[model samples]
Target: MKSPQDWPEPIVRVQSLSDSGISTIPNKYVKPPIERPSLSNSFNNDINIPTIDFLGLFTSDGNNYANKSIIYEQISEACRNWGFFQVVNHGVPPELMDEAREVWREFFHHPMDVKQTYANTPKTYEGYGSRLGVEKGAILDWSDYYFLHYLPCSLKVHNKWPAFPLSLRKVIEEYSKQVVKFCGRLMKILSSNLGLKEDVLQNAFGGDRDIGACLRVNFYPKCPQPDLTLGLSPHSDPGGMTILLPDQHVAGLQVRRDGHWITVKPASHAFIVNIGDQIQVLSNAIYKSVEHRVIVNSAEERVSLAFFYNPKSDLLIEPVKELVTKQNPPLYPPRTFDEYRLYMRTKGPQGKSQLGESDKSQDEK
Candidate 1:
């Protein structure tokens, strides 16, 4: 019953929330489960989402390395068991993260004409403004974002980058370099956990093929109505890995865990790493790409930078043959990134399912 002008800047409330700002999540929007999610017998408490701390990397004591392994085990468990986890203390420098945030803000603040010059062209899927889901979707979510696909550097036009702020490009370039390095490190860790050589995952990602990476800057304005809209709809990442650097003070990011929506508490100088679908296939189902969404706050504008590391569009994604056996058969067939991306667009914004080549390919020897 609240009008857009009455409630808040970003959140548009069609239905009102209870006094405590809690309300029933409409079933129409809940993510469909692979199988029905079971409910608990107890109706007395709220669910708790697990948080993975990334700070253990710095401890000089034996516990640092010990905790590091423990965290890795927990992360592997979360990936195979829960599909996602939050990470802090990741080696990416906090100052770099800070500067990356500044660059995104500066880019988006450019005059509309300048920003639009890099606007998504007919076939290109990079650059400023409300992306794919915003303009044509059936639902209206309260968020604005810019996407930059960084790999295959020739694919990127450094000139397309904004010239304001004088140092914006330099900052973004540095941040991009750091993120790519972080991605390599994560692949090594994940590969080790999967009982494979440390370089297994990295080789799968960029082996004889280019890697695909993109940076997205999302802005969720203060909404007048907080109950009726979503900042980002519930969905899983369609790439290899995602590294998110959220705003320090504002908390609106949440992931679906167990059977409920768990709010992700933002930490200063930390990055949240998530495994995406392609990694799931590469790991032979040892890892998972979980579903997540963002909530909009009515109080202040929320900003987040999500750097997506993807496999090159042409690389064929399949389970490493070594991972499959009679006991551990392959769950998916070989498919190219182009095939998967086309599947994603056809399914529209909220579509699930990692579409591979075809069912016929699943029968290959």
Candidate 2:
């Protein structure tokens, strides 16, 4: 159990694994100080996460209504059952997605000092770093990531934005706009499926035009002993929804269902969308926010971009009145987005939903 303060700066960046020129795993990276389940035989060949198509939502032909209805049903079922789904025919331009990945790959490959120019501190949580949790003795993930606060553009820290690749900033800005738009559309569809007004979620998020959003760009380099460590621990997301663009060549993302872990296959030119804890609370437990994690591989490096959509910091989140009834009371009390963020930081990633903790506190009172 080493405290974060005592955990010395990582001696080797995972990205350097490719250039180490060593044919074998190093002693330092061989075993994690904390013990975790061995993943050597965890793969299940028969189970896979569902992939949904969004092309029906944007159709202009006379079949638009019929197609939308079918798509809506699929989304509703996926959210209620798995809390995760991959979407194809999503509107994001494929070229833009490729460019975003290229820019980030270049940025991560920069010299150590160059990448450290925008290093993150324990408190700020925005910039390039591998440290994610604040708890002492917490098992660290085997990856490096850069976090950027993209929404409420006025609140962005301009200096923390990387400038090395030069094209990084411009490409990211464009990608953010597209992602935000797609999120709004997806929220509307979810709201309709839940039998609420189409704009219910958008309005709750302070209208479709204004909302808080953030992006986490992750780079998981090849590991010498992949079975002994994890790329990211199992945990549910804390925001409203997350749009993940995963590496096409590597497969690592997995979700827990019925006490079994199922691999999520990445779809070409599509984004994986999953409901977050807030959305489950908002839906009064009708939908779920399931536990999911990433596995590391010995052969290939993986890159993923996750865009988290959230309400304004001060917005109150709770079960919608329409979804609550005498027969079904709100499962969790109202909490502001800022309060939830603080709670998650203090608690760290423990493979549990914070909303469940809120329910327990309320029950005790």
Candidate 3:
């Protein structure tokens, strides 16, 4: 395997090709027939990932106990059954969400040179990035993205963030502040649901201030041959959890459910949440991170923000002590977020391939 710093081929922005008015995507972007999006014969139109209302769910003290309890049960069920859900009245101003998204769209429209000024290297993958993984000749995704770190203060460098679109940096800062707060609260709720101390998950994630957080702004350019390629390939997220601010105008995210793929319809002003691998390890398989992907379109382009709430890269994440037992011992070996994520860093995504080895113990029995 090549070093992660060495990208096997020259980097090309998908937006440039989309804007060039090319009728055919390059061969590198095309997946084999079996992995193509249109090849899936089962697309469920009537179903969607669950939607939960966050309004008044955590307002007053215990006065709303019954209602809050009902919501806890709903979230618990959502995590176990689908590993994904949409939240409305999530407290982030809808106006802020709109502005945050628009600024990134504006940034992407800037001249290629301006955007390229901050092009990223595989080492940190912290700026304008067109692809994931470093494998030579790997089939590429039909998208480009801007990635930046937000937590642990040291990695939060304002200079590295976009300077154009004047409002871009500020909106990104404010947007991240709100979403990070929301993720912290959700962590507590999840811990309580697992019958562990409310702070268990947070502590495991390196406490309140030291946890790792980052944003990946995805731009899925319009594809002429949308059927032959995908905006993103099928894979489970590698972090703790992901909060997505989707383009409400289009439906592209597909969730794998019991042998069928369900296209998710974005609820206006709501955020989509999905479980990630680290959480599955911490939850001792009480919840499994489901495989999902994004699809591009022939008519319009797309932009979405994926906010990843992850654990401290160096700390070991494993099945919590309470969840392990003689009959139900740890299903996954303890692995630090850094070590567990090396597979994707070099080889890209391959449908739970990173965790498949760790999952072997469970499969054996």
Q: In model 1, which runs have C-alpha deviations exceeding 4 angstroms?
A: 1-67, 133-137, 355-365
lDDT string for model 1 (1-365, tens) is 11111111232222222123444443333333331212211122444345677675545778578778888887788778766666766778889888888777766666566665765532455655453432332444556677766787767777766676689778888898888887787777788888899887777777524788878788776655556556776567788899888888887776665445667776568778788878888888778677767777667777789998888877888997779999999888888766666555434345235543322231221
Tens digit of per-residue lDDT, candidate 2, span 26-139: 554444534343632345686767888887577677768887888889999999888999998899999999889878888888888788777776565788877566655455
Error at 245, model 3, angstroms: 0.4
Q: Which regions in candidate 2 have their CA more than 4 angstroms from the true location? A: 1-12, 16-43, 357-365
Ranking by lDDT: 3, 2, 1
| Residue range 1-365, candidate 3, lDDT tens digits | 23466467899999999999999999999999987888874475689888999888768867788888888998999998889999999889999999999999999999999999999988888999899988788999999999999997989999999998998999999999999999999999999999999999999999998899999999999999999999988888989999999998987998887766789999999999999999999999898788888999999999999999999988999999998999988988989888766778777877777777333332232
Whole-model lDDT, candidate 2? Answer: 0.78
Q: Which ten residues in a row have the lowest lDDT in candidate 2?
A: 1-10
TM-score of each: 0.79, 0.89, 0.96
Instruction: Flag regions of model 3 displaced more than 4 Å.
Output: 1-3, 357-365
Question: TM-score ranking from best to worst?
Answer: 3, 2, 1
Please give the distance, in angstroms, between residue 97's alpha carbon in candidate 3 and its true position after superposition. 0.9
lDDT (0 to 1) per candidate: 0.66, 0.78, 0.89
